[model samples]
Target: MKLSYYLLCFFLVFTSCKKTKTDLTKITAKTIAIDSTITSAAAIDSMVAPYKEKLAAEMQEILSYTAKDLVKNDGDMQSSLGNLMADMTFDMANPIFKEITNKSIDFALFNYGGIRATIPKGNITKASAFKLMPFENELVVVELTGKKINELIHYFIKNKKAHPLSKSISLIINDNKYDLKIHGDTFDETKNYTVLTSDYLQSGGDKMVFFKDPVKLTKLDYKVRDAIIHYLKKVDTIQTTIDNRVILK
Candidate 1:
């Protein structure tokens, strides 16, 4: 009887110590939707009100004056607003670039999409600039070859939008062929040209593939909006007009 009890206890202990070989139960997560409406807390609003008011006041401060209305229109080869934006970028950025690299920017180019709003006649303020340029793009010089210039002309003809180009450049689409002149001189294939544009173009923005790999890339590290603001202030009155910068027959 004693031997039988010991054997039964050993059996019980062995069964208890044996590990189970069963598979783990799978877990599936289910989503429970919650209400998405958000309400502002008064404590947060009170903390932000003062800074917001100051920003609004600063944005409305007058920077300069406009002699006439500057509007951007599609299908037009040149627009007052486009010319002003491109010229101002060149004027403001080239000098600083020259000061650093001792080389001047041949011309400036910006996409029409970059112009977000229009400027009416009379007081030009920080608000107007902010509305015009909302992006914090930096000014850069892209040194492209003459072949690249031809590519740029072809690009213009293909798109046919009033992309901002400086006065120094004159592009005429003749017989579906590109006829372009830079700085009042015929393009020289053997020579290199310096173009002023935003780093956006440098990174292949707006399908500007030619600017992707330029001979040299120089950054002014100045925001384009800041350049426009400074240019507006430097020039007491803005008298930019639509010239025949781009003409097609």
Candidate 2:
């Protein structure tokens, strides 16, 4: 009887240990599967392979094309590329502002940081724009008082960097003073004006607190880079020139 009791106790303990091991194995297997799902280089590569191939092919085509007309017109590839982006800045902002706000915007401000590179002359392709503006930044409209608009201009000029302006904006910079003109009209401090800019600037990325204090803000679903790409596709023929919208001298 004693031997039989001992045997039964041993059998119970053995079974419990086996069950615990099985549970642990299952938990470890599940953890490994979850980790593999996200970190698997092969899976990621498979998903991105097609896009990579397409971009490579497009870039190759652009490189092969000669810019006979552009060269004859004394146009460089980088200038043309800058014009493409600058033009898109206006094209995308004007119509969208009319559609959403029903009020025409005074001008659009694009951050200098947003422009990655000059579009090379010749065959400008979608892939080239991607390389130029890699970030997936979207367009945003911020309504600010005329005072804030002057402040924004001062910030841009003080930095001495290039920022895209959609409409006619002139800044007369003197010793610690700036005279700003928008569309041939003097800026009114009491009057409200809508300015189209990127979400990045609105978020105070470039020390632009004016947008942060905007009376109204709207975000568009369109990415700025993607907008440029779409614009390029629509207008196959591109002219490269310096608009000098942001003049240093």
Candidate 3:
């Protein structure tokens, strides 16, 4: 009888201590409306005011002046703004690439869609640079084979858009055949050329797959917008023109 009583107690304690699995039977959610009912926190506002004021002033500071509006669609195959962008990239990135690899960049090519905004005929500021290129793309030089260079030329010819090309290349499209010149020399299929472009394009962006799997790729670790800002700061006046870098004749 005593044994039976102890067993009953032990069974009761074991059953009580045993863990039971929980299964979610149902879930309910509540929606909270966020309207004008919320008020700005005074402490947070005070903390952020000083930084905002400094940034506003810096953005408005004049960097340079332009007598004529620099736009990307002002010409048939080239524009003032596109030339400036491509030239600036070549000018800035070539030095860095030379320092690292001891080789000069053959040319620069950037897409028309990459130019975000135009420089109006007035004072240019830091805000202008930001508006023109809000992306954080870095410059890279890719050593492409002569075949790849031909492919690049073909791509440009097919697009027929005013893609920014530097003065180093003169591409004249005629009928189904095209005449190409690099650095004032005729395009040679036996030589490899180093081309300057952004990291985005190097990764095969915009269907420019030729940039991938190059002979060599050297990153300049320089942002395109910073180059523009640097160029703007160094010049009192910004002057650019549509040249014969590309002729669709």
Steric collisions counted per model: 0, 3, 0
Clashes of 2: 3
Off-target runs (Cα >4 Å) in candidate 3 are 1-25, 31-37
lDDT of 2 by residue, 1-249 (tens): 999999999999998878443343443334344654566578889999999998778765432222532211122112334444556766766687788778777777766666676555578766667777888788888889877887887776666655566536655666557676777787777888878778888998777777897989877677887677667666656654555444443
Instruction: Give the Cα lDDT of each candidate.
Output: 0.88, 0.67, 0.91
What is candidate 2's TM-score against the reference? 0.68
Question: Per-residue CA lDDT of candidate 3, range 57-77, in tens?
Answer: 999989999999999999887
For TM-score, candidate 1 versus 3, the one ahead is 3
Task: Sort all candidates by TM-score, best to worst.
Answer: 3, 1, 2
Residue 76: error of model 2 in Å?
18
Q: What does candidate 3 score on TM?
A: 0.87
- Please report how far candidate 3 places residue 28 from its true position, in Å: 3.5
Per-model RMSD to reference = 4.0, 7.6, 2.4
